[model samples]
Target: MTLIEEVKAIMQRSASDEYLNVMVPLLEDYVKAECNNTFRKNGKTVYPGGVKIFIAKACEHNLTVSGVSSKRLGTVSYSYDLDFPDSLRRLLNPYRRVRFHAF
Candidate 1:
């Protein structure tokens, strides 16, 4: 399945197509930035399986906490710092590129 279709399935029809079209690519770009753009090399691009899932999950998280820095639900409260999530960062560790400089 395509990325949008896969993400839509996981979201369970929560987001609109227009929103997904905009957010999915933005999130994918975020992932590529976090991983140092290794997915693109020498005019060829590739994405590992996990990357796709990560993008979908990130989209969900963004939709869940689109606005407001903090929210309260009954006795429960949540805060959004808007930083890249640590959990998502873990997923990208395997793909992160490291460069070494010559001495």
Candidate 2:
């Protein structure tokens, strides 16, 4: 299986919302690394390695596997919506404030 597939499999097996919470950062890091490699080779300003696509796919899979709706909170924000399971809601609070600005 490919690395992405492996990551998907690992995500599929996790139960705790905390685990999903932790996985997001790791997946983002993976995507960023791939994007950087592509940018380095192609000299492109945009991420040409489909990092966003991968992130979306991984997030979708995570939601489906966990039975939650992972909605985009903003351009660079995401959160588990109201449809998430109660167990998860208690563990994953999406209402926490976060700050980000685009220059």
Candidate 3:
């Protein structure tokens, strides 16, 4: 599939070229980084599911729609988090791209 087709299918619509330009490279780099080596076979993906993996990951990273915030109580006890969801990890797990950490 072509870039436009992939973007539309993944993003659920046709995003701007500028938006795609940014995310496509980011997606490529992210997969390569996760592979910890190469993510290619004969100038293409080594894995058949590679494109879906990239799409899922890039979509996860692109969840930029802001949530509503309130300071109604007149206190300063506000918090924000941007942790990745478990579903996303599950989606990438089959590709062995799920990051693990020691803490």
In angstroms, the error of model 1 at 80 is 3.9
**Candidate 1 residue lDDT tens string, 41-80:** 6786667877877877777777775534787889988877
Best-to-worst ranking by lDDT? 1, 3, 2
How do all models score by TM-score?
Answer: 0.71, 0.28, 0.57
Clashes of each: 0, 0, 0
Q: What is residue 64's positional error in candidate 1, in angstroms? A: 1.2
**Against the true structure, candidate 1 has what lDDT?**
0.77
**Tens-digit lDDT string for candidate 3 (8-86):** 5666545667777676766666656665545567897544454565564555456543322333457655443444456
- For model 2, state the Cα shift of residue 102 in Å: 41
Error of 2 at 27 (Å): 2.2
For 1-103, candidate 2 gives per-residue lDDT tens digits of 4444444554434445455457656765654553333233456433322343454346555556354446454675445443434443232222223445899
- Minimum summed lDDT over a 10-residue window in model 2 is located at 88-97
Query: If both were scored by TM-score, which would come out higher, candidate 1 or candidate 3?
Result: 1
Question: For this target, which candidate reaches the highest TM-score against the unseen true structure?
Answer: 1
- The parts of candidate 2 lying over 4 Å away from their true place are 1-25, 32-45, 66-103
Q: All candidates' lDDT scores?
A: 0.77, 0.45, 0.57
